[model samples]
Target: MKASRVASARSWLRTSNVPSDEYLEGIYYVQGRDFVDAGIVSSEIKKNLKEKGIPESIIRKVAVVTFEAEVNIISYAEQGTIQYYVEPGSITIEAKDIGIGIEDIELAQQEGYSTADDSIREMGFGAGMGLANIRKYSDEFEITSVPKEGTYLRSTIYVNGK
Candidate 1:
């Protein structure tokens, strides 16, 4: 099941969208147990982008990237924020959390390396693919964490695939 999810993410990244140069952006406040709320916000953004003539492919990338980031926060952080930016050159998705930060970012990035306990695992989440999927679907990715401070993850998907 995890393999299939990963494969599906890979497929999302493979699609291409027509390049845009206009700047667009949105911000979302993410709370724990609010995946549905996040999804609604994401869908609105996707719809807006599509109406603006942003290709479906690019919108899909934004959805996938944002969903992964949101899920990570929902599963791990007590609270967090997800920011979306649609620039002329690229789309940027950032997740910032105020909770126990990642102790080893390197290990966290590795596929199948998860810290989710039995409770989270029992829910069929925390396969440790969140960060990996975010990185895989993005053209540029960066992550930072401070023990007890929190974690910040950002991913950029270029409009022109640059």
Candidate 2:
């Protein structure tokens, strides 16, 4: 049963009117509650981008990158903020959280290092691949953390005018 849930095809997206660039640049906050809520928000962003005439390639590119942010917030923080910038040239997604906070940013970004407990591993999340996957798909990435303070993760996805 648990295995089935992890393997289920994940499609996160919803459609609404595409907001103007000025509006997209505004800050937004999303609370963390496991994977479900993050997935919903991610889907909406994808839909927003698609409505802006962003190509499939660019839309998917942004989706994968931000999905990492969504997962990071949901998995690590009790709540998170999505402050974003949707511009003509690129989209910047900033996901911030105050949680247990990463003690070692370097180790966390490694492809196989995670602090997630056993239960997280059972859900197929603690593969130590979250940050690595985010970097692999993003055009620019940076992470800053302070012990007991929280973490600030920012990623920039440039459309390359596709």
Candidate 3:
């Protein structure tokens, strides 16, 4: 990502870094319903991982998971954030969103199940594959949500195949 772009993103995105053992970390805030900005977080992440010399295979997994999470946030939430940490053995990504949370996570996890509206489908998204794809690409995955509150998702991809 360019310095100017990162600076601009930080302005509206309210990004922050918290010191930790991880080699790299970034938090990108997502504005709900902003389809134009939907993939920024994932693009930045993929760039960062590439610069760090992370293997392409692993990077691909991270990209897929991050993009899916980002899309879901844009499609469903009032607002959300995607936080990523790169560790020696694995990369972890967490997406938390404030919205009408999933009522049935189990059902949502099933392929071809979606609550997306007509507009989302019109955009050629909301194929009901987001959650399923995220889980498929991660070595470890967990999700939790309260019906009227929000949703939180965490996924970890092992650097050295699990």
Per-residue CA lDDT of model 1 for 1-162, tens digit only, reads 655644443333222234454666666666654433435445656776777777777788888888777777767787777777777778888889998889999999999999877656665567988788888889999999998888999889887775
10 residues in a row with least lDDT, candidate 1: 8-17
Cα error, residue 85 of model 3, in Å, equals: 0.4
Top-scoring candidate (TM-score):
3
In candidate 2, residue 96 scores what lDDT? Answer: 88
**Winner by lDDT:** 3
What are the RMSD figures for all models against the true structure? 9.1, 5.7, 4.4
Q: Give candidate 3 regions above 4 Å deviation.
A: 1-10, 14-22
List candidate 2 segments past 4 Å from native: 1-18, 21-23, 26-28, 33-35
Residue range with the least summed lDDT across 10 consecutive positions in model 2:
7-16
lDDT of each candidate versus the true structure = 0.74, 0.70, 0.87
lDDT by residue for model 2 (1-162), tens: 544443332222222334564445434455544554446566767767776677788788778777777777777876667666777778887888987789989889989997777656555577889899888877888899987777898888787842
TM-score of each: 0.78, 0.79, 0.88
Clashing pairs in 2: 12-43, 13-43
User: Please, what's the RMSD in Å of model 3?
Assistant: 4.4
What is candidate 1's TM-score against the reference? Answer: 0.78
Clash pairs, candidate 3, are: none
